[model samples]
Target: MTVTSARFGYDDLRGLITRVVDVKHAPEDSTLDVLWTLYDRVLDLSPERLDSPDRDRFYLSKGHNPGSFYAVLAAKGYLPDAWLDEAFTAGSRLGGHPDRTLVPGAEISSGSLGHGLPLAVGTALGLRAQGLLKPRIYVLLGDAELDEGTNHEAMAYAGATGLDNITVVVVDNGSASHGWPGGIASRFTAQGWSASEVDGRDHDAIEAGLRGHHGTGPHAVVAFATSSI
Candidate 1:
């Protein structure tokens, strides 16, 4: 049920993803393909206008591993290539996790799990309040993060408020201590949000899941990996 995304052209994107990662900081590998598809295909934000109020916002809620997030940012020209060189080194801006103040395109500093989705809802609401309805809000979260009560509150509010401009992509790698009973997508759909699941490793499927919903509510795309979660 993969829906085709609206047309958007990209060049040398895989090459750019490669340029941002190295052996020492290779934890980003799992998210490389998905992140690239978002930055290179779906999201409408850019590095030049990091301060633009009209720019789409992406909040990385799963900050435990930001290698892929950093890679996507660098590939999209949000940070200099040299930022990779000193990544994780002493006093480096690019540390174990992402900091919005340090990274040009990073909208918020993330680390305390389960905080991103709630923030994304606020961002979308704030945008709507400002009469800037065109800019969409996106938040990427780990499947494990959904176990938190904060995410539940956020999704419920978004669904009730018809926050259709927000998109939540849950990277399900089966790492959650308490696995979801039915499915992750069901949780969102139950709360009145449009929901879908897709192959996490396939770029086409991921993009489609991200774009499938055409309703007047928020969306949830659960990218399922071959692994447990």
Candidate 2:
């Protein structure tokens, strides 16, 4: 039977991810609370409608490591709970990086840097073209991932075109090799996107940031969350 992550608390969920993933990583820890909040409270998604035409989409654009993504999928009933334990084992479908073909509910295959945002823009545009504006497209990227030129072009286009259905959640733990000047949210704001910075671990704050931009163009949430592993 599929069990919802809501049945368990933060500590239990965190521990489950750690035990399944085995190794500690900052991006995972920094993004854990936000991911939990999105899957458990914000995103209109579930295991039942993985192939539905009108379902919302989530893209893990920062594809370097996806331990939290995998764990959240397990906790949210998108996959078998037993699969989490087999993550990274030989022949296991779960790997350090997510593959859309192998992972159900994975919107983007997301192998290289700076691909998710552009692809997400296309998805949002296509959805709108199909008159499916009710669905939301969310892309999760890292502070470091923003350095890629591909993301810059994508964000600029989304903001300029007013893709209000797109929401970007940037897990900012200050890991960028060359940090963004004048803060991370400023980048989104300058591009005409509604942007907010909040504590990543604060579920309430994260939820607010994720949902506060109703008609304000493309939205972005900069989660200055914990940097520890």
Candidate 3:
């Protein structure tokens, strides 16, 4: 059964994170703030209109660590709070990687790196083809995942095609083995994308970064999780 409660809020996210203890990485420290901000302020999505064609789509590319993702979904009443307790257990819908078919609010079944961004691009194109222009697409990925050539190719294609309906959030915890020379934002800017860097932990800064871009092409937000895991 679905559980929606007015009592769920930002403060309750931590408790929900603790319930899912099987995650291999502590990505919650870096991603929780941004996840909360997106669900709370940026994305035009909710539990009620999850299947609506006009609803915004958020693809979690960095799916290896989904504690914060699930927490924000529950906090925003997208899924039952009891499901968090059963995460990664036998028969539980919540798995190590999010499955779109199983999870109520997940837009894509993501776990493999370098796939979500491309999939999001394809989805945006599909939406445009269907004349569903009101919806926006958001994809969140780890900095380390940028090492994949497919991501760069996808960024170039999105930028070249002027896919303005898509936005990419890169959570940078300094995890990239071979870092970008001019910074992560430069990688996108070079490919004609509007890019910006912000303090990942600052909600206001993150909100601004997410909404600051007004380019005709896609936008990228490099959220530096300097003080986080």
Candidate 4:
């Protein structure tokens, strides 16, 4: 039974992330652990959702934080936490970047900043080609990732193609990773996309934004998160 992080408010989520981040030097490691915790505690979480033609797809574009991703998977019952100890020790399945073959729930081998969303768009298009339209593709991007031209190209393409099934999530913690002027949402909107700006730590806000969302084109969700872990 997965516990909906929903029950926990933004403050609570922040606390959890803070704790995880403080516990490790590598924020990616902390994030992986948190993802694991969510998996373990959250109900009905599974990568199997991706297998069904009608199910949703998610791509973590901020693949540098493999530790967080891995942890989340382990918590969700996809990967074993013990793997963390072993992989970090040797040339193990777990590496600095995500290896989809080793991690079950990870949708793509994400490390290249701008590739995840494009890959997600492709997946959405592929599913659309197969006549599965309702299920959408969600991509999580880091603030720093915006600097990559590939991401902008992907966003522009998504807008031009009118990919209503594609959603772009940007996690911004006020970091200088990307030259996000004013705000990322505004840039997305300028690119002809419907954007939603929210507190990344707020589960309720996140749920609302997600549920209330109707992607006419590629929707960009800007999450102003302070700490990703």
Candidate 5:
């Protein structure tokens, strides 16, 4: 049986990392742990749903934070917690970036931004071909990742394909340095895609954005967040 997360809030999950970091006497990467909890709960609480062929798929396009992702996967039982301590410690499957083959639940080896969305198009198309229309495909992107030209290509493709079974979660931390281009939301709309902005730090808002869609075409969820990790 798979272990499910207890619907803990982000703050609660962050607190867990604070305690764990203190116990392990390793404070350097504790913030990463908090981020991992999101994946942990996502995988756990929604395991059965996710595992099903008709269930939704999550493509973690932002792979720079694989450490936190691995740690959470471990906590959720997909990986070994020992890997957390030994993480990036040499000769470990857990590296700075996710290797889909090595990480059981990871959908892609995503160090490069803008790649997952395009690939997600293929997955979404494949699933549609298979007649699995109930579940959608979600791609998680970091704010800085928008710099990749491929993302723009993907946005255009999604618009052209009219893929209603696709959604993108933009984890914007406002630290992307260059910041997202102005009129991003409008741009997506002009391309025949639906777009919305939300507070990334607000769990409720995030959940709402993910749940409600126009069923017209692809959707882009821009989440504005400020993460210390």
Candidate 6:
């Protein structure tokens, strides 16, 4: 169930992260800031409106280490703060990878790389087909995940189709085995996407980069961090 009380602040996030024990994998430390910025400022989603057709959708494609994602969800009151204590345990719904069926606010079950963006593309198309154009589709991806061929296909398709309702945030920790030549933003721009690059740690820059898209086509924001998670 969703909580209706006042949401926890940034200060409470560290404590929430510490609640999870025996976590085999943890999201990039940089992801904490990005997740917080989205939930706290950018996203038009809340625990109370999970079922709303007009609510925006956020997919976490970089779900190998979901500790930060869980913390953000807890802070936003989508999941009880206490549930975090049992994360990854046998009895807990929270796991190493987020499950949409188990988590209150998760829009998709994800862990395998390269699937989230494709799924978001399909979702945007589906929503448009249903005349539900108010909801935007947002997906978070890791820099390394871009190496997947499937993601390239999805990116090309979304761009060619003028999928303006879609926004992709790529946390670039510089972990991609084969890095882009002109940088990540160029990859998207070449595919007809509106793109921007920003410091991953700067909340204002991140927000600006995300909002910079003006409904031309799909937008991609590459958040560069100093180190890999």
Which candidate's lDDT is highest? 3
TM-score of each model, paired residue for residue: 0.87, 0.93, 0.94, 0.79, 0.79, 0.94
| Models ranked on lDDT | 3, 6, 2, 1, 5, 4
- By summed lDDT, the worst window of 10 consecutive residues in model 4 runs over 1-10
For residues 47-84, could you state the per-residue lDDT of candidate 4 as single tens digits? 44635567666677788756556555544445555565
lDDT of 6 at 128: 93
Question: Over the full model, what C-alpha lDDT does candidate 1 score relative to the true structure?
Answer: 0.78
Could you give candidate 3's per-residue lDDT for residues 28-50 as a string of tens digits? Answer: 76988888889999999978888
User: How would you encode candidate 5's per-residue C-alpha lDDT over 1-229 as one tens digit per residue?
Assistant: 3444333433443444442233343322422422442463332235444357866677888887555455555555565455555556567777767888776667788887779988999999999999988878878787678778898898898898799999887766654666656745666787888888876656566666666579989998777665453
Candidate 3 structure, TM-score to reference: 0.94
Candidate 2 has its poorest 10 consecutive residues by lDDT at: 1-10
Candidate 4 error regions (>4 Å): 1-26, 29-50
Highest TM-score, which number? Answer: 3
| Greater-TM-score candidate between 3 and 4 | 3
Candidate 6 off by > 4 Å: 2-6, 21-27, 227-229
Greater lDDT among 3 and 6 belongs to 3
The clash number for model 5 is 0
Model 6 per-residue lDDT tens digits across residues 178-217: 8887888988999999998888989999999878888889
lDDT of candidates 1 onward, in order: 0.78, 0.83, 0.88, 0.63, 0.66, 0.86
Write out the backbone clash pairs for model 1: 174-229
CA shift at 161, candidate 4, in angstroms?
A: 1.7
In candidate 2, which residue ranges exceed 4 Å CA deviation?
1-9
Regarding lDDT, does 2 or 6 come out ahead?
A: 6
- Give candidate 5's error at residue 74 in angstroms: 3.2
Question: Which scores better on lDDT, 4 or 6?
Answer: 6
Backbone clashes, candidate 4: 22
The parts of candidate 5 lying over 4 Å away from their true place are 1-12, 15-51
Better of 1 and 5 by lDDT: 1
